[model samples]
Target: MSRIGRLWNSLANPDRIPKLFAIVLGAVILIGFLIPLDLNVDQLYPRPVPQEQVEENISTAPYARGGEVLESPGITRAQYPENSKSLGWINSYMSPLAIWVASTSPYFGTSIYSSPGGLIDEILYYTRGFDTILESTILMMAFVIASWLGVNFTMNRKKREAEAAADKSKDYYDPTLNKNKTYYYNNQNSNIKEEQD
Candidate 1:
């Protein structure tokens, strides 16, 4: 069999069961994205507006209560939000979206009240906490990585200095190894010349 085919067979064996676990984990993440999970916001938190206020606004019939927009007789110029142009439609659409997100999903849902306006507040409030935590974690991780790099650099520098000290010279030779010396006997040169004659 081909090498690649053998590898495939090996991976398919029961011994490589960890691949199944990895597949399961990937599936869970995909499902989480498709079907949102519950957030841990109790009803007590962030304070629900008083029911009396709601009832009063309803009785008055002119003022809008947060999301609720009211239509009036002979008022053609009924100023409504661009998305919620009229009270009736605005109340109809936004209410359900907010309730669904807030009550069902991990997102804290739409903030009905905001400084400047409600929609801007909703955008900021729901996402602010996560953004803050993410930023903070990234900053902290960067600091840690930088510190680790500095320590490693210092250690490597010290090691090089120690090595340089040990290797003071590379052409190292023991003095005892050069004990033998050469001698020249030029005095015997005249005797060699007389024999040759």
Candidate 2:
């Protein structure tokens, strides 16, 4: 068989299949958390709500300038959907969840994760960093478990080999010719000798 065939045979073994699946799953999770998807902001982002709605929703005091409510200009502010806003700033690459965490989180009292073209800056860098850490941890655990299983298999194989060798040696050279025939061979032999003598 070819090298590829041998490799496939080993991988297809039932004992190794679970370990292979774990490694693949870990890699996929790591990639999913690391790689950011490219998406259009206009399609995903919600329109800004008027300040009037904001005041009404929060039940906060109305803005007053010169004792005139009209002076506030009815400030218009961007409204970010719950758990999603920072995804708009797709600088180079950024994960959707990381962007969401950064956008929802407060930075300089603004909803955006960063300033200057809304680039994915420190906010995404740090937030996503945690996911990378978790992925690495899982990968490490898989490696350790696989290594341990390999060591155990090797040890068991060696032990069985040693036992087989001992059995063959006993069959070829037995100290007592009939020892294998009975569990109490030595006692029975002594009793027979005593009765005869």
Candidate 3:
């Protein structure tokens, strides 16, 4: 058969159903991470300062009293930056933070780059270090538990099968039949053989 036919048969097998489900679930999670969804910054950081209040405070501040304000604070929008895409969030916020750490940190300074490996390193070692560690530890513990359970299940099944086989063999044996068998005896003094039934 062809490779596709073999793969289809494997996927259809009951024993591989769980493994296939895990692969599909993992793929979905990977895709979700890779594809960034558009989100509102204001919704994420909802606390808003009034434009007038900010202007008054800046104008009254000692340094700003003499200097002119270059740009004025604009009106607060319910959702700021209309039609903003997901890339903006990464470029404006996450990338700068990651770049700063990659540049300044001695451990990551040399290896960190604008590549996928660098992004993974930044997440695993810097951004979400504790979370990554916890996730890995949890996955390890789950695997160990699953393996132990599987071993115990197979052992118990084998033990039960052996007991069943022993019981089946015992059903073929009869003590009454053995007792009724003819017995032959030799008499040494008389030099004669006797048979009893």
Clashes of 2: 1
User: Can you write out model 1's per-residue Cα lDDT over 25-105, one digit (the tens) per residue?
Assistant: 999988889776777664311333555534553321222224433333111222223532432223212344544553453
Q: On a 0 to 1 TM-score scale, where does candidate 3 land against the true structure?
A: 0.27
lDDT of 2 by residue, 1-197 (tens): 68887688667556689999999999999989878888765642223445642444422212111111223222222234344333333332324553464455423223343232222232334325466678789999999998897776654656654665668655554332334545476678768656633
The estimated TM-scores of all candidates read 0.22, 0.24, 0.27
Q: For model 2, what is the error of residue 132's alpha carbon versus the real structure, in angstroms, after optimal superposition?
A: 1.3
Better of 1 and 2 by lDDT: 2
Candidate 2 segments whose C-alpha is farther than 4 A from its true place: 1-38, 42-125, 163-197
Candidate 3, residue 144: how far the Cα is off, in Å: 1.5
Query: lDDT for every model?
Result: 0.44, 0.47, 0.45
Report residue 13 deviation for candidate 3 (angstroms): 30
Candidate 1 vs 2: which has more TM-score: 2
**Candidate 3, pairs of clashing residues:** none
- For candidate 3, the 10 contiguous residues with the lowest summed lDDT are 60-69
- Candidate 3 residue 183 Cα shift, in angstroms, is 47
